[model samples]
Target: MTKDANAATQEKLGGILEARDWSRMHEAWHEDVVDHDPAPDQAPGLAGIVDFWKEFTTAFPDVTLEADPLVVTDDFITAVFTIHGTHTGPFQGHEPTGREFTVRGIQVSKFVDGKIAERWGSTDQKGIEEQLQLGTSDAQFVSKD
Candidate 1:
């Protein structure tokens, strides 16, 4: 049961990303889905999910997410994915840098029926900032000779 649900959810996500279809979000997420780690300024529910993706795709028009094999247990599905994109548009109050970045993320989702009811996730924001030369981190790589 859980495996079937996970497969469906994965397929739906793939379709959504591949087509950049925000309208089809309801096919994979419950109407009142809870995102435990919502993006900054992202609202609640499925609409928030759609908005987040829309904003993300706008910022990184060629963004792609590649997931490792999913791990399913009970009603939970865990996915580790790599996100690759170029900063081609405004994002988070910063102008486009025209730089590319690759970051990793992990999400754990709880499925109810066949749709995602709740989720928690984290992405490597610092890595993105460093890659894009954004944010205020002053640390520099030094060689030990």
Candidate 2:
């Protein structure tokens, strides 16, 4: 079960984030998946989640997420990750800044039948804004290779 959960999570992340395969989302997310921390103006359920990602990808076409070691227990998996991207399009009512940013985030997902049924998490939005507006760097927050 753990292996299944891990594989599902990996496939979900890779397919959506890396490959930009929105069509495969249904295979990894339950139809009624709950997001505990939905973004502002985001709707409900799987379609909403997909819409959110679509908008996000539009804003940062070259975005990438690098996750640290995951913590899995039973039906739950938690990951700490860093989001790297450049603001190249409109986002949250703000025009493009063309600035690169790195923001850290953590997400906890609950899997049911190998699909993500629920998730709770938050990212450093304030930090991202600072990087964009002030042209500050998040180098201090980045993980060492």
Candidate 3:
């Protein structure tokens, strides 16, 4: 792809997350897309991807997913991003604490035919739990990459 096409793909990817539009996000993926780092209890494919996002955004309606500066390759994009939001609903079996959290992460998306074919990511789950006053500070997240 040309630089222009890469830029447009990045723009569209970022826009889908920022907009939190489930349908558009699902449509951006290939029919057999694979998410290598889905949330607990999430299955595979576009159905699982959309379901995961729907539940997450439902709990954190005002969440912001900002794509930090990224590196784009011929068929992949690696991004560092921050997810910030307030706890106003149930999350991970916990009731709302009215607290806010900010977690940073990195994701690598591999594309095929201009659609996301696979994804792998890691996030600051410990920090998120701390912010929400859930698990102890010593909590850890097993590597998902």
Best by TM-score: 1
Candidate-wise lDDT, in order: 0.78, 0.75, 0.73
* Candidate 3 lDDT, 1-145, residue by residue in tens: 5435655666785678667766786446776788887777777888877776777777777888777777887788888888888988886577888899998888887877777789888889888888988875433331111
For candidate 2, the TM-score is 0.86
Compose the digit string of candidate 1's lDDT tens values, residues 27-58: 88889999888877778999888887887888
Residue pairs with backbone overlap in model 1: none
lDDT of 2 by residue, 20-50 (tens): 7778788778889988788777778888788
lDDT winner: 1
Ranking by lDDT: 1, 2, 3
Per-model TM-score, in order, reads: 0.90, 0.86, 0.86
Q: Deviation in angstroms for 84 in model 3? A: 0.5
**What clash pairs does model 3 have?**
none
Model 2 off-target regions past 4 Å? 134-145
